[model samples]
Target: MNLTTTAKPIVIIGAGIAGVHAAETLRNEGYEGRIVLVDRDTQLPYDRPPLSKEFILGELSEADISLRSNESLTALRIELKLGVEIVSIDAKKKIAISSDDEILEWEKLLLTTGSSLRKLQVKGSDLEGIHYLKTLSDAKAIRQKLDGIQQVAIVGAGFIGAELASSFKKQGKEVTILERMPLPLAHILGEEMGEYFLQLHQSEGVHVITEDAVVQFDGTTQVEKALTEKGRIIPCQAVIVGIGVIPNTFLSDKELHVDRGYIVNEFGETSLPNVYAAGDCAMWPYRGDNIHIEHWDHAVNHGKCVAKNLLGGEPISYTAIPYFWSDQYDHRIQYFGHTKNWDSAVLQGNMEDKQFTYFYLNESGVIDAALLVNQPKNALAVRRLIKQQQSVDSDLLSNPEVNLKNVHVQENEDKVSY
Candidate 1:
């Protein structure tokens, strides 16, 4: 449907970073049709990445992270239906029925429902003091309770888990990280970078426990202690589970091709036509890696691509150079690209000084992925090599004498891979 002519209003089924930007992009792209936003959250669309870091650290507020203002929504004529759950979908009829019998019709539907944190199924899982930083309310409750507590046990040492550890330590809480992995953040950042991260947290007075499994929780009602596989019972007043989030695709039907995330094509079109998906909830082509990321930048770029494609423009496939950032223990960690089975890792600079870049390369000496801790400018260059899938001189990439600025990204026409 050409939006310039008479077009049915676009219906967005989320108020997350993906849905919010998708609706906002439609207006910026000059679509005058009414925009209807359906969300399960009562608060308006706000950034989620900051919730675990800056918001918990007492640096940024809930209002500061919002992408759109009341003025912006007023000028755009966006209709918000908050605290409503979509009951069922009749895609053939182009109509969605909600729990309140509020049926919505649309020319197109964008599913940006995002994700939910994976809950630990152990005992004391439903304890009151336990929390997960996925929503605004979750952050608020955790922040309110943090002041009274001095000891905290965090499970899963991923970005969210590590950031929470950093934030709590700043609040004078004794943070203990319980990670099942031998090295912290090994999957994405590799061993060298992960080791540096482990030291960084420990140097800041945070206790680090590795290769330990939580066999059980010892508490009557609230989580008071966690028993480890090594037979260590650690005392704690509060617990935060950061095991990671699973894409909210429970509402998707068989035609949608749901994996960990809703599978979409290059244009953000699902298996069904006229139905698009984006953000943390959606997965598109990565390079030749068959990888998927839930990064903030990826969500924003994918939403914009969907908006442009919906505008009736001859769709150009989107190939994003994956870039993501994290803040932990006063260090800014930025990573680029998907590293699949790297054969060698080359490090530049000193880890003890808290500044370095680690390059993940294949056996043939091509830079598949790279991560920078406290090196912001180097992140941009590393992103280029990984995106282009270009080869690098192993001698130069490993040598400390070579300048990273001399690196040039190959300009091949890269295709989006699923």
Candidate 2:
């Protein structure tokens, strides 16, 4: 069935960066069909990255981080449904039942339901002061309670945890981080770079305890202390958990292929016809691997790419480079491309100077990914090199004097695309 010819609305669940971008793309691409953008969140779609940093630091307001204004969404002719959960989807009938039992029939369904925060089920988790930051409301609650918070304990030393540590320390609160890994971010950035970040926190006066997991939280009415697996006790008036998130796949039908996430092909098409998925909830094919990236850049590009395919003409494969950034204290961290494994990580510039880049090279010396610390100028060049998939001289990549733009060999069409 040609989706454009149908009068039924194109229903997109989850009004996040992905869903909002998809809705706008549909309209901008000249699709005249009705569009419905739904989300359980009542607030207008807002940028999430700041929730851990600027939002907590009071540098950026709730209105400042909003992705789109009400007026913009209205002008696009997109129907906004807030505070409504998509309870169930009837694949055969092409209908969605919401939490209110309202039915929405669609010519094509796009699942951008995104991901949910992974909760720590430790004892005393229900205590009043323990928090998880995933939404604007979560940040607001934390901010409102900050005046009474003196000591803050952060669980999990991931991006959220690290950023929270930076923010809390800046707020003049005694901050402590509990990480299960001996070296935080070692799983992704390798131990060398991880140690650099671990020190980054310590240098800023934040206490970090590694190789320890929070087994329990203890308090009377509110969390006053955290008990770790290593028998260490951390005292804190407030605790923030940022272990990571699980892809929201509750609305997915059994007929839809599901792996770590809702599985989609290159064009974001799911197993069921007229049904598609993207963003954090959808895992797409990349370099012969099915992967899910939970980041703003990927979501925005993925949503737009999928929207074009939904218009029913020549299909476009989703191949945008995966990117994500983090702000910790005064440092700006930017990473481009994605790779689970690399033959080597070549470090250029000095970490002690607080500015450097780590290039991950494949077995054939091709640049797979790069991590830039306070070196925003090298970002565009690194991205171009990774996408080109051309071999680079390790000597040149490791030298601080060498320009990254001049470090690559001629691009080969036969190389594997990122």
Candidate that scores best on lDDT: 2
lDDT tens digits by residue: candidate 2, 148-182: 68999999999989989998888889999999999
Candidate 1 has which clashing residue pairs, if any?
none
Provide TM-scores for the models: 0.93, 0.97
Candidate 2 has a TM-score of 0.97
Query: Per-residue lDDT tens digits of candidate 1, residues 1-418?
Result: 3566345678888888878788888888888888888998888778888898888877898889887776778778888888988867667888888888888888888888888888888866777788888888999999888778888999998988888888888788888999999888877776766787788888888888999978777788878898898998889989888888888886666677888888888888888767888888887886554456788998898888887777786885778877799888768888877766788888887676767788888886678778887888787667766766656766667666667777665456332211
**TM-score of decoy 1:** 0.93
For residue 88, model 2's alpha carbon misses the true position, in angstroms, by: 1.2
Single out the weakest 10-residue window by summed lDDT for candidate 2: 409-418
Q: Model 2 Cα displacement at 314 (Å)?
A: 0.5
> How does candidate 2 score on lDDT?
0.91
